[model samples]
Target: MTLEARLAALAAAGQTITYGKLARDLGLRMEELTNALERLMEEDAAAGRPFRAAVLRQRLSPEGLPAPGFFLKAAILGRPAQDPLAFTRAERHALLPFPNIPG
Candidate 1:
């Protein structure tokens, strides 16, 4: 089966997956997975760093946090569509689905 297929099956089972699981499920060694991930990352480097969950910080605590915790969304950089408040008026207008709009 494909890697994505395995990943989807795991996701449907309500289970979280790690690189190790992905590698094992796809009949790949950890090093192979690592190499593939590295190649993907390298390709994305020209378009800003790829967002790897393993590399990105999902949440962070304040410097003086003594309470339960604090959190913020991990950054999704690179693409213009991914950026909020980062478009021209025409660009925003173009995103409207006028054909699907009801009177």
Candidate 2:
């Protein structure tokens, strides 16, 4: 499947997916997935849309260690919605570095 198709499929599933898992599922290297995501983000920005790829780190467990891993989900911005799993402000700042994006 094409990268766009894979992204659409994940968005349709409405679930966040770890990079490692997504890479394996897509038969792509981890770096390939990351590069694709970066390209997608750039495309979205150039089109005057809020980035659709939300990259977030998994939450920690009671032991204060992450339970799963870093993940990304496709989302529509500028809409009335809630992502309980959305990354914290600090996390977004740390993960994304788009100059045109507002926090």
TM-score of each: 0.36, 0.51
The residue pairs found clashing in candidate 2 are: none
Residues 29-62, candidate 2, lDDT per residue (tens digit)? 9778777776776676467654445432233333
lDDT of 1: 0.37
- Give stretches of model 1 more than 4 Å off: 1-16, 52-103
Which candidate has the top score in TM-score?
2
Candidate 1's residue-wise lDDT over 1-103, tens digit each?
Answer: 9644453344334233455456777789967765565544344445553223122111242221111110112222233333322322222233233523543
Q: Please state the error at residue 37 of candidate 2 in Å.
A: 0.8
Q: Which ten residues in a row have the lowest lDDT in candidate 2?
A: 63-72
CA lDDT, every model vs. true structure = 0.37, 0.47
